[model samples]
Target: MWEETSAVDKYGASPTGESFEPGRQRQVCTRYKRKGKRHRRQTGGATRTVMALDSLPSRVVLLYDEWLKLADPRTEDWPLMASPIAQTLIVIAYIYFVTTLGPRLMENRKPFDLKNTMVVYNFSIVGFSIYMIYEYLMSGWANGYSYGCDLVDYSSNPLAVRMAWTCWLYYFSKFIEMLDTIFFVLRKKTSQVTFLHVFHHSIMPFTWWFGVKFSAGGMGTFHAMLNCCVHVLMYSYYAVCAMGPAYQKYLWWKKYMTTIQLVQFVMVTVHIGQFIFMKDCPYKFPVLLYIVGLYGLIFLVLFLNFWYHAYTKGKRLPKVAQKSKALQNGNGVHHSNGVAKEATNGIFYGTTNKVANGFHHGNGIHNKEK
Candidate 1:
């Protein structure tokens, strides 16, 4: 049996009977057998050989091509006269114009409500976020950059046009984000539009511009990937809150959101550090180093300040309690529905006096009449 098996090969053809050496015969027979097995698969062609264009939705490819034309930033007829520095300056000027002009124009109007428009807006942001994550996870495993940041290093692995379209959507979303401040101004929520908010909003569009410009396929895809995940949760929370009472408790992890943002910055910094310290890397590091450094410091300061104000200082509000007591006494309890009342303390105080007084009115609230 062993002699027969050795004499025969992957193909039914007897190797010893063939003119070629048994090893060479076996190699050819194995290949022939493999091809025959592949033909049995339900799909016709090898998946890797399939063109992405064949599977891509027609509208997406069209839009992607259009966006490429607009966003390419490469042209001899209209050459890039100014460096990225000029573009950065232009963005700064635009920020200044909006910050100054927007307030005055919107002064009379009420702040924008997160009710109807915010729901749509957040849904869109989160939807794009999901697409970004999907693309990132898919490409990361396949050994390719998800976003256009791949040019920083050449990837032998090919990506689909759909992946390219998804990345373009992520890129354009940065432009649409300018409306975040517009909404803030319309609602007279200018106080919320801090320098951190404006600066972040301003820089990101240009940062992504350069991201696509220099490193059109590389480690930077992780930045978009991470941001998308964060935005998914963040905007979903916003959308839920906008829906009135539907899912108000959905964002129970609001405190942790800031922590996650801080962690993201730390991770980005560390990743950029690797690029800087490494002796051998395929990417150009100087540009990425500047971006990562600037981004890290800015986010660290902004996040720490936000954490302090939102949690730390907020916890130390005995002064607010004292003021509440003062206002309570100053209002003076009144009789209503056969009951009396007394003064109390802060925001967290109870309605004990309301129970005694039967019905009472204070601080824009009406208690039940006894």
Candidate 2:
């Protein structure tokens, strides 16, 4: 990578031996020697001659110095970087609208057919999640990261800067994912916005701001990477679901999706648990790690409960539907194939039993008795 310099002046150089500008060459060498001393004095430990030439590392070094001076001023003046309080308020507003006000507004109205919209949104999220995973890995984790006791790297190293960018992108994605609940509202799929779902979506962005602002590179980042991996699968599932009802036949993996999610949260918990056992890691931000760990535990418990109700407990009919079924017999019966003995229990519970009718009902599915 050295830049070659000729001793001869291009304007005039005698053949072979004697140089016409020997005095000028001597002066140039002296100036270079003085500059070298200054560079050494200023650089101190940053005497990484090779490292200084790399594009990303050089840019990171420049930006980090700039960042130090503007950290406080730029933060106050900036939009998203203002303060944690502002972010918290935004989250609170989001929660109040989606769970409370938005649902109420949609109460009397028919559900909007947001199939196309949901398809686009979910797939977009899947793409973003995958990109984040790549950045997190290539940026730092795939490098010298210990994944056990690694601390936040504040240096302007290329890997560190890339990691910071990924963390910021991850934080921003949380904001975008707020649309998940909003879509549920628009489509009147309010039931999908469970307590766990609401809490997860609402809390992520607010908490992640702290992560991006401070510890963007370190042991704390493993969960975010894992979460991104899970989201690639998770959002892909939702995208397929949004394609239409015809796709339901291909959705036999729905049960396994929940299982995968449970596994994701468990991994998060275990990864964060390393902090507790490590004898000497100078990770200054244990608060975030604790929060991340507790958050994982909370969701694990919630997902477990959801799995129990969804799969293990079997389906239970509602009181109103049960009473109505008990009182009725052949009232709404339509006998084309045979007989449609029962009314539908929403879309989830299709036909249950069939006598002459082409249907069978076990758990709230419409059925015909022989």
TM-score of each: 0.56, 0.63
Lowest-scoring 10 consecutive residues by lDDT in candidate 1? 356-365
Top-scoring candidate (TM-score): 2
How much is the lDDT of residue 229 in candidate 1?
A: 78
- lDDT, residue 58, model 2: 74
Candidate 1's C-alpha runs over 4 A off are 1-97, 110-114, 141-167, 305-314, 317-370
Model 2 per-residue lDDT tens digits across residues 216-287? 778888888998887777667667666655665655654465567678888889889978988888887788
lDDT of 1 by residue, 279-308 (tens): 655565357556755676555565565445
lDDT of each: 0.53, 0.65
- Lowest summed lDDT window (length 10), candidate 2: 357-366
What TM-score does prediction 1 earn?
0.56
lDDT of 1 at 13: 57
